[model samples]
Target: MSIQSILDIGKSGITAQRLALEVTSENITNVNTPGYSRQTTIFQTSFVTEERGFPLGTGVNVAEIQRAYDDFLQTQLKTEASTTGWSSTVLASMKRAEQLFNEFTADGLGKSMQEFFAAWQDLTANPQGQPERQAVLARAQQVVDQFHRINGYLTDIKREANQSLEGITSDVNESLTRIASLNDQIKLIEIRGARANELRDQRDLLVRQLSEKVGITYLEQTDGTLNVSLSLGPPLVLGNKAAELSLEPDAANNGYYKIFATSPGDNTAVDISSIVGGPNNSQGRMGGTLQVRDSLVNGFLSDLDELASSLATEVNSLHSAGFGLNSSTGLDFFTAPTVTSGYSGIGGIQLAISKTADIAAASVDPVTGGTGNNLNSRAIASVYDKVLATSGGNMTMEAFYNALVGKVGVAVQDAQRSSDLSEGIIKQLDTLRESQSGVSLDEELANLIKYQKAYEGAAKLVNVGTEMLDTILGLIR
Candidate 1:
């Protein structure tokens, strides 16, 4: 081979290896940067020439700059991010709900109910004592106050979940728009036969964030664009256009917010709450928040109202049947409930009689003390052991209350377990992804050394080729 050909081959090798070294350096620098993928140069042989019908070897050229990645691994990460986000949100909300139940604590409903019943038991001892009647009234009021306090706290929990839902939906919409813009950039760059490796990484990062807020499914098109959609709904982003999500206040549901999605090409926005937070979905942060507000909180409120209504009805029934110490007949101990918005249960629970003399301690109109006239107070105390009206008539008031609190505890445990399991899966999948796509300083430093040596060897060959060319020209001159 001619000395010129030798120089040409050496130059090509130097250029390719130098680019490889630069890529290795970049990997090392971006090792800690989020969403950065490791890259490497792909080398290929240059075109060959024929001399006397035999092929002459040519030097190598860089085919393309290829980034290290795996499609299936990225897909797995997105899916698990949605799942983990869901359970984590639910676990937090349920923890707040558990605090209100306070079944095991002294300041909770269990303690108040026991004290209220004990006051009635005290009344059975002195059928005509004015002080005992006054004590019973005080205990009943405390029980009523506790029910109001717990229900109010539960409403606040539901409100916070709604606020979180609003924030998550906004974030998901922002990510969708950004991903669509990245799709346009990637398509334009790849069309010109260039690698948009960094852009692809940025776009993938946005996709991961979107999935964490709302579960989604995305597919890559032939032109390297993505079509993104809700997990069970229509397209959210198509090519270069993304959908905008907005929430409308639902008048039918206590003016709570409902989600709506509008694509760039479509004027009408589709409501996606059913697909997102409905019973079909068990994914994403918004889904978990919606479940807390709509399902768990409401159920607890319903059970609490039943307990208050039943207690009031049972006491008033027996109290009105007996005669008061003042000889007044048919007087209810507890007043009728006044209906109110969001709280028809415990809002109007007040004592019916104004004075302690109205205490019904006799079954007859005139009680002369030694008769069996304390029967009405005894019946009122026994209401605690009776089956709750809404416990399917199988469980007593105390047993039913314990079960209601137990339900909240069970919800918290299930959410925590789900969050933990999903997090374990995400961590394992992350390790696997890092092995395939993430930058490693140790691996990059070794690559730096390898590429630097190849560049030096190519430079030495070029130096040798130049000297050999100089000697040949000197001889010819």
Candidate 2:
């Protein structure tokens, strides 16, 4: 080979080593940057030529920069992020619901119920006493007030969930648009035979954020664009276009929302609310919110309504058959429904009688209609021990209340357990991903040393080539 070719080879080697060192430096600098993948410079030997009967070797050239990544691991992370996000959100909302019940506090419905029944028991001791009757009325009002408080709080929680759903939908739409824009940029760069590594990493980070809101699945196109979809429904992003998400008031429940996705191309809208829960639920933060509003809170309200109806019906029945101080018969102790359908549950229950003289405490009256027998009051007091209408009549009022509170506790515990498990899985997956794609300072330092040696060796080779050329020129002279 000619000395000039040897010099050219050394120059190529020096350039390649310099680029490798630069790439190593970049990796080291970005080691702590979130979503930054470690990069490695690829080297390729230049084309070889023949010198007489020997094959001559050319120096190295920087081919391409590669990022350490695993597609399978990335997909697993997205799935885990979605799950963990759902469980954490559900656990938080359930805790709020549990707080509304407040079973451990004195102001809770359970205590009010016990107080109401205890007042009735106190009335049985002195059925003729006006003070005892007044106390019973006061306790009854407290129970009704508690029911109203619980129902109102549940309504507020449902409203908050609906409002939050709107916000989440907006966030998801913004993310879809950004991801679509990134897709366009990435495709443009890749079409020119260049890697858009940084753009890809940014897009991936956005995808993980999106997964927290809703479960997602994605496929890479040949032209370096992604086709992203909600796990159970229509595509969210196609190439450079994104579908829009919206929320509308639920027809059956005014305080909740029905989610929809609209295709940007054809302007087609599809209701996706049912996908929030059921066998095909996506199981993300949005899904958890819907479940809390539609299932958990609503269930508690229904249970409260049942308890109120049963209590009102039982008291009215026992009081209706007795006589009051004025010998007034068939006077309901509490308000009775005008219709034969009984009390209209929690919201409709009211004090039927205004005067304490209207409280019926006697089963029978003397000839003068002045008897103050305490039999009816004793019977009303026994309502607490009797199995009131609760869960097909197997539980008393207090037992049913305790069961309701217990159910909430169980749900919260279950959600927390799921959230914990999901968090552990996410940590494991993240650690694995870091091991594959995260930069290592020690590895980068080693690469720096190797490239530095190569640079020095190439410089030495160039010097040798220069010396050999000088000798040749001297001989020629």
Model 1, span 66-162: residue lDDT tens = 9988889889999999988889998998898888787635788888888888888898888777788898878877887888888888888888888
Stretches of model 1 off by over 4 angstroms after superposition: 52-54, 337-354, 366-372, 389-393
Error of 2 at 211 (Å): 0.9
| Residue-level lDDT tens digits of model 2 in 88-172 | 8889888887886666346888888888888878887887788888998898888878777777777787788778897889999
What are the lDDT figures for the candidates, one per model? 0.84, 0.83
- Per-candidate TM-score against the hidden true structure: 0.94, 0.92
Q: What is the TM-score (0 to 1) of candidate 1?
A: 0.94
Worst lDDT run of 10 residues, candidate 1, spans 337-346
Query: What TM-score does prediction 2 earn?
Result: 0.92
